[model samples]
Target: MTMTMTKLPRDLVEEILSRVPVKSIRAVRSTCKNWNLITKYERFANKHIDKATASERDKEFLVIAGDYLFSLNLNETHSRKFDLSINHRGISIAREHSDRTVFIAQAFLSQGLLLCVWRNVIDNRSRLLVWNPYWGKNKWIECPMTYCLYEWFAFGYDKSSGRHKILRFSSNNGDRYMEIYDLSSDSWRTLDAASDINTIKYMESGLSLKGNTYWYAIDYEKEDFNISLSSVKEEKLAVLFSPRDRFVIDIWVTNKTDPDAVSWSYFFKVETTQHLSGFLFENFLIDEEKKVIVIFDIYGGANNAYTISGETGHFRKVDLRQSPYKRPYRLVGCYIPSSVQI
Candidate 1:
């Protein structure tokens, strides 16, 4: 008996296509011209994102492991060490640069696409490329200048223009310069990013949430706050400020994030009992609904995610890394699958 999808409504067909894995996107598109047209819409990407989240797809991290680009599923066992594979020419543009000296220094994922910066150690040169791992689509961008050591890269979309953009900024010599590369226009424009007075010198763990970029940083003139840069999502602000002394821990949140004026509402406070190092805050998430803070153990290399309860002040470590990782990997960020084109 032969099956037919011709009778199904377009919405039904879309729902089915959204359920299909992003890895098989090529095959799905080739199966039917209608399917190709449906998948091209932005709404279909949104539907696919919803389907993935609803299905409990393990949160993935797109990592640059030495010369290889690997995906590590944070929630699964064994796969944390990476069972997934990548064999695409787009990846090769960054992974296997003809110069040989050039290597993928950093990567950021937005809407199922990856913005990669290929660094050449010998010449101190950089190459920027926007790549879709799922579709094997690659767009190379000319780097106006070499990305310095302190300069960081972030990938986000412009809501108004509906274009994917890359932001590269660094606060070097007490001054900051921000440059944005627009994927649609294929151009680079500099933004008068910051002044010396408000410049952030020590910044790390930059995260892009809801088209706005946030980072965890330290000011030499001010105090430091321990917060989860990874667990940031939503319109409301959520933060974990467990000072270095670690006597009392608390969660503060607010509805407004206005630069001029904003106030934080007290969420919960947890008294300290167990000894958790500063590294625990490296890659963390605030379980707002559950009132728990999950911290990825990067220091121990034990492949554990430390989940701590706010009320009980108790925590448990779940081992996610199955094998010993030899190469030191710099975190790009949470890898979210998107059907959106680059």
Candidate 2:
């Protein structure tokens, strides 16, 4: 008599793979043809996302320090340098290049992946890279320069299409333009949405939550009463949509990704305590499970971090002196390290 191995059913295999860590799923797919097919299935992706979100874990913060990237604890007391190999333009490059080390300018987190806008240390040429830290893998996307003056970028994942997108806005000679890149197609297209908010012109990093992207902006012109009477009246109606008189930070959400029908909405606003005049809101991240919003602010030359209750509107500053590094860390995104291979 001889013993034989039995193969599990496809559905049973899928159920098991969906529950596994996202970073490990890529390897799981390689085990067999059936496993590979199941892992790439859309239903499997959705199930994996649900499992990943439902799991409870420590919140990790992504911070930029000089030419390196760091993942810090939410309490700001401990940090570990991320040592994954990073490459540009599909060419593997060593991070040890001190004279021409690459730096992340803008970054956003989607699911378990980190999307970054990086600049060359020598020539300052900008490019996009999507990195799966747990798996130590990244893919580079060439960024085409559309505007010569100023440019801003935002990253989001479109659940409907199962695609990642980068929104680029540039201004030249006071004229603003918008373009979008679809990772699936590996191409860029112009966005013709009629937007006059003037806030997207300067957004450095966008927050991607639940397949939607958001930017934090302050409507200063409307809040200032000393401006021209005609302009003040025009902005009065807009200000009413936001919180009154307080230090209001407007939340703008991306509504559509369709090039022909792209749009946005002023989703919500948060009013902070008074004396926020000199403070500049740099970046923010949301803890959906805990219902907490962490916003980073810059005052003078120091770091000002706050954790606010999403429901109560109460907030308090987070002390960062306990950390070893004294310099302000630019909080760009949130990172959840998993073994999910991309």
Candidate 3:
């Protein structure tokens, strides 16, 4: 009753391993010579590398608080934190310029670049900074304004033009303006659009996906806000309406619930009560490979986080107060390809 490696086709085994998470595949590589050879194949390696990168992006959420930034690794029982504090030189410049600092402004991440904006204290100007934290390289561009400076802003990439655009709306004038920065040209130009008849309110927590930026908005009625999604590439807008009206919209990334498929479901909360809604819904990171969404909620002065499933919608809460390190406010998290890491 001896088992043979030839019993299973090599292609079949490769397919199975490709579907597994990269961590599991790494463990299997050491199991035997045949497994190691199969896992090390260039084709298999590239496929698994992409899968791992996408899984990380879908699973991790960058938490930005005050001066400190950290990455929250939610896969383990306790979350891991990585500090991203700028050096004294960078910190002093960031504090003096105001616009160079990364704050709670509209943030967009793509390729290896993170685009963010802050205010300039010396000139009272708004500036956009493009930086690659992974490589410690950054470039700053000043934004030109006509009247009052924008209180809220968003950063997005326009795929069609192959450039980045900054969308800012002024609360005082109820005007929304767009500035297109051609990364290749290193120039900026303003966009002309009809006035927004309705008062335009901006939400800081917007999600940028597929060259489009989506933000939560409250109508002039001062009631519940609706989800407003816009594409910088197309320069168009579309409204995504949820079933309930009183819900606070936060974006979640999950492949299990396809938007076009009949099984489409969104993970969010309807504010049933003031304090209770905050307790039930927590900001989380989605683990696509594990098929789980990890949520961290600081309630009752206790930092409790959990991971939920996209398919089953099951919840499990883990306490993190006992952990030595606490989650920082400003943190950067990214999923780099194994090839890139090497």
lDDT (Cα atoms) of all candidates against the true structure: 0.61, 0.55, 0.47
Off by over 4 Å in 3: 1-60, 76-104, 120-125, 145-149, 174-176, 195-201, 219-275, 279-282, 298-304, 309-342
Report the lDDT tens digits of candidate 2 across residue range 261-309: 4345443455766555454445454444344555555567556666665
Instruction: For candidate 3, report its TM-score.
Output: 0.54
Top model number, TM-score: 1
Cα deviation in Å at residue 83, candidate 3?
19
Ordered from best to worst lDDT, the candidate numbers read: 1, 2, 3
Q: What is the lDDT of residue 233 in candidate 3?
A: 16
Per-prediction TM-score: 0.70, 0.56, 0.54
The 10 consecutive residues of candidate 1 with the worst lDDT sum are 81-90
Q: Indicate whether candidate 1 or candidate 3 has the larger lDDT.
A: 1
User: What's the distance in Å from true for residue 33, model 3?
Assistant: 34
**lDDT top scorer:** 1
Candidate 2 accuracy as lDDT: 0.55
Query: What's the lDDT for residue 260 in model 1?
Result: 50
**Location of the lowest summed lDDT over 10 successive residues in candidate 3:** 83-92
RMSD of each: 5.7, 9.7, 10.4
Clash pairs for candidate 1: none
Model 1 C-alpha lDDT per residue in residues 15-99, reported as the tens digit of each score:
8898886546667888888888888787987887677655535344555545556554423224222122222211234455565
